[model samples]
Target: MADYLSVSALTQYLKRKFDVDPYLGKVFLTGEISNFRLRPNAHQYFSLKDDNAKINAIMFKSSFQKLKFQPETGMKVLVTGRVSLYERTGEYQIYVDRMEPDGVGQLFEAYEQLKRKLADEGLFSRPKRPLPRFPKRIAVVTSPSGAVIRDIITTVRRRFPIAQIVLFPALVQGQEAAQDITRQIKRANQIGSFDTLIIGRGGGSIEDLWPFNEESVARAIAESQLPVISSVGHETDTTIADLVADVRAATPTAAAELAVPVLSDVLAEILKEQNRLYLATSNLVKNRQNQLNRIRQSYVFQQPQRLYEAYLQRLDTASRHLNQVMTTGVTDLEQRLQLVRQRLLAESPTRLTHDDQARVSRDTDFLNRAIQQSLQTKRQRMERAVQSLDQLSPLKIMGRGFTYTTADDEVMTSIKQLHPGTKIDLHFADGLATATVETVKPHEEE
Candidate 1:
């Protein structure tokens, strides 16, 4: 029993042995990742495995934050960390301090991931703006000493010398280059006068042009109010900035060409327009003069009175027709007046009065007959109604030997309403009598 040790004691001893070993303290391992799940704002736990075996790996949040690319399951990676044993679980694992993609394939994988993420967010799907056909002031964001700006300036000067060029110097390489490029883009916009922005650098390796691929640079280009023309690296190179910009150019010289029109071509077009205007003005003046000549040669101008000769003849014929119409209209009116006078005499007041008097006499007789018949009908109705009411009257009922009694000025309908010695009034056909109730009894009791 003295030689036996508990599981906890053995685990602790092994953990210490793994921790203090110098080779295990900083081991460089390369293997394929397995079971890797990203835990936002927390530590990552996964396994690194080769064909021979597998080892569990853990990366704390602080160390994982420094990773340049996302680590995923089945991705080959080179990790530098330490081997340590867990006392509680009795498992040996690697605590990764640093990790990176194993090869170029991994870097490309990271680029694809970012590309897909930005695409999902509609950053690449946004409508691209059209570059100004003739930019007055172009802003260039690139290395001040680079050949990119030189090519742009030379092309712009050779083509459109009157157009101004403003340079916003920025670092086009290295880690800090993305931030500087973004700042220059914003600054150029803040000035509020630049018509177009050209962002680029000379030919370089992917590492040298990585800043243009950065998310910050892409976002800045996408959000720019001014149109952006991206010309980065060689003709074959395309970056995130290029994808988001309003226009993409293979070289800086090509970008300048897109930004402004050729000075000679524009001047030639203006001269051509001027010549066309002169030709048109000459043709228009000649056409108008020819029309004036035709008008002068017309018969109306030759005779002068020919314009109103038909009107004078029309006036003479119209005057004779109007006089004849007036004579015929007067004769018709005279005949109508005589006919109306005869009709007036035929409808004189004397005849109308006799007819009106006869109508009144007949109406008076009819009214008198109607009044007599209405009075007779009302008198008959009253007699019948009086006879019916008399039949049902209390006086009439008393005359038939039936009487009613009232107690407290109300008719007594039930024997229960009266008791012995109750004062009551008896109403008969010819008189009303007063009496006191001696004995009140119902018909059943009687």
Candidate 2:
């Protein structure tokens, strides 16, 4: 220790060594995360650790923005960055430029993370609104210079040239791209009378297509008042925005195709319906004509008098049958009248008048005797029951011998309720008397 090195001096030397050394400047590292803290300002401070050692690591807001999944403690990560020294704290750390989930593509990892989050929050489970079958105006959010917009325009023009297309220019990748895309989506909604929104971009690597996976962009799509169709990359590439959007398309062209129906196809269908109507009318007219021809060729139309001839023959046959039926009916009526007269003579009242009269007289006498006997019996029984009831009646019993005494509206059966000076009523057979209760003498049964 010939000369003690200052902290700044040592850090500066270390920084210089990190800057020049090929291995230190750029490195691809794999390790487990520890002591990870996500900053409020969108930066990450953490330590990367292995079995024997650990090193400080930092992910700035810009680099962290590219990550698909949030880094947490005990997570394995693969990071590509440079090793550098923090002169202030005299600590050497790795400044991560790019990061990916271990053993998984960053885009897929991000998709899973966003899917889980949105599913938990019910954004993905929310009822999706149906897109308008015939849109008045379709607003497209994509790169202004990319083939995605061109493909959409060409497809829409070929299918439905009548519908209007409005383009909202946005960056599909790079820094702040997600925010720009979200801003354009909102701005397009405010500035236009667009019935539908198509957000899309051309296919690319996950790193080149990270913006569409941002949570802000996904939330923007979810909250949009206009129905949003997300067409990101090819059919294979799905972004978080796709999950929350009202509809998802395989490609930009597919999105435009979904937005409007083909005018030529509709015209063809109309033409087909018109042809069917014409054929049906022609067939109906032909059928009616054939029926008229058949009627004209028949004997009735050819001769004209043949219609009356048939009626004349039918009238003759009906008249003959009617005369025969009338003759038979008169013969049957004469026989029925003769039988009825015979029955009437056999049942005549004059034939048995004496016997009927004697029987009626005998029955009348018997009925009168029976009624008189029954009435006498009921009267005697009723009288005896009345006498018994009279004997049981309180008034009748009291009339014979007993009397009733009461005090304070209660029968004087006991002395418990009576006081010495209480006034009482004594009831005999026909009258009651007032008496003072001088002493309550409790009666004992003999």
- Best by lDDT, which number? 1
**Cα RMSD for predicted model 2:** 16.2
Per-residue CA lDDT of candidate 2, range 238-306, in tens? 678888899999999899988889999989989999999999999999999999999989988789997
Which 10 successive residues of model 2 have the least lDDT summed? Answer: 103-112
Q: Please, what are the lDDT tens digits per residue for candidate 1 over residues 1-446?
A: 98999999999999999999999999999987765657899999988876677899999999999988998655788999999998879999999999997753343455677788889989888998888777899999999998989999999999999889999999998879999999999999999998999999987544467799888999999889999999997675677888889899999999999998899999999999999999999999999999999999999989999999999999999999999999999999999999999999889899889989999999999999999999999999999999999898877777889989899999998889999999999988888899998987678855
Could you tell me the TM-score of candidate 2? Answer: 0.46
- Root-mean-square deviation of each candidate, in angstroms? 16.3, 16.2
lDDT for predicted candidate 1 compared with the true structure: 0.89
lDDT of 2 at 419: 88
Angstrom error of the Cα, residue 338, model 1: value is 7.3
* Backbone steric clashes in candidate 1, count: 0
Q: Each model's TM-score?
A: 0.51, 0.46
